[model samples]
Target: MVLETSSTAEASIRAPADEAAAERDLARRAQRGDPSAYAQLVRGNQGRILRHLLNLTGSRDEALELSQEVFLKAWEALPSWRPEARFHTWLYRIASNVAYDLLRRRQLVSFEPLPPDHDTPAETDSPEVRLHAKQTIGQLDAALARLPPEQREIVLLREVEGLSYEELAAALAIDEGTVKSRLARGRAALAQIYTRMQT
Candidate 1:
């Protein structure tokens, strides 16, 4: 089921302790085969998961499809759920694996970036300014596409998804040191690419 955008934002603003308690409760219920609890989990996480996948794959359609797969996998794996990791981090790990598998099957290196959605206020900007903004976004997207998949994944997880070092290590199944090293390299590479594009 599609979650409303407003609800997602509301979920994000919730107190962390309260949210974690709720998530743990829901996870417990879901592990016990409660469909409603599973549905709640999906509603809570769908937006961020979709956004993360979109940035990773650079295609809304692919992201949407892969997100469905992610939820399904999560459902199937619920019985094995342990609270050792945060539910969202587990979901991200699933999403990363799903995106990587699809990219491999399709033999795609990267996707061309689409224009930004209508979130930017049209009333505030002149056409020339809007055009420039789009161009810059496009340039950055191309630079992101040029990164190796491992580097790209690290950059997207750290920068776009805002995963912490520990969270990123959990999601990517790497040690924290590896996450730090890859992120540093990824940021350096992205900066170089962006610079070259500007020149």
Candidate 2:
């Protein structure tokens, strides 16, 4: 279920309208209680959603649990879904809410620094390269962890999840202008953090 980010970006750029149409059709069928349609939706999206949650929470176990909750919530709410929003956007909204709720409940929780299995280096990588990669990821994780929840969410959705500005606005219940502003601020903050870490 490890989705290639390049594929996601290519797909998003290639035929968003066609993809939306297909998702809408599946959603309609799922709303009508088509188990196969729902399963297909889950299979297609689970990896992306889990990756986003992992980036947000920095914990694979929490991400996995929250992802299951997200799909379940999506299923229960499927009947009321309107096709005005893309299916992935709607699911992202749900996932964001779930992550935010968890963050609120466990305020200031300490996340482990890049769990072993979360993003392992390739076996072919030299030890020095692997160490460098791990250190970079750790710095990035620390920077993300320090961001305000809203800013962090925006950054992850835009940068890590490769969500379009429109999708981010819909998923976060913000306007596109707001998405741009927040993304700018988030990136700036992250840059500052990285610079400080480097020093």
| TM-score of every candidate | 0.86, 0.87
Count of residue pairs whose backbone atoms collide, per candidate: 0, 0
Which 10 consecutive positions of candidate 1 have the poorest summed lDDT?
Answer: 114-123
Clashes of 2: 0
Q: lDDT by residue for model 2 over 1-199, one digit each (tens)? A: 3478888877888786787788899999999999999999999899999988887787888999999999999999997789898899999999988987887788855444546566767889999999988888878888777787788888988877889999899999999999999999999998998899898
lDDT digits (tens) for residues 1-199 of candidate 1: 2468878777777777587788999999999989999999999999999988887787898999999999999999987778888899999999999998988998987666654771243557998987887777777788988988889888988887788999899999999999999999999999999999888
Off by over 4 Å in 2: 1-14, 109-112
Clash-forming residue pairs, model 2:
none
- lDDT at position 134, candidate 1: 73
Q: So what's the TM-score on candidate 2?
A: 0.87
Number of clashes in model 1? 0
**Candidate 1 Cα lDDT to native:** 0.87
RMSD for all candidates, in order, please. 6.8, 5.5
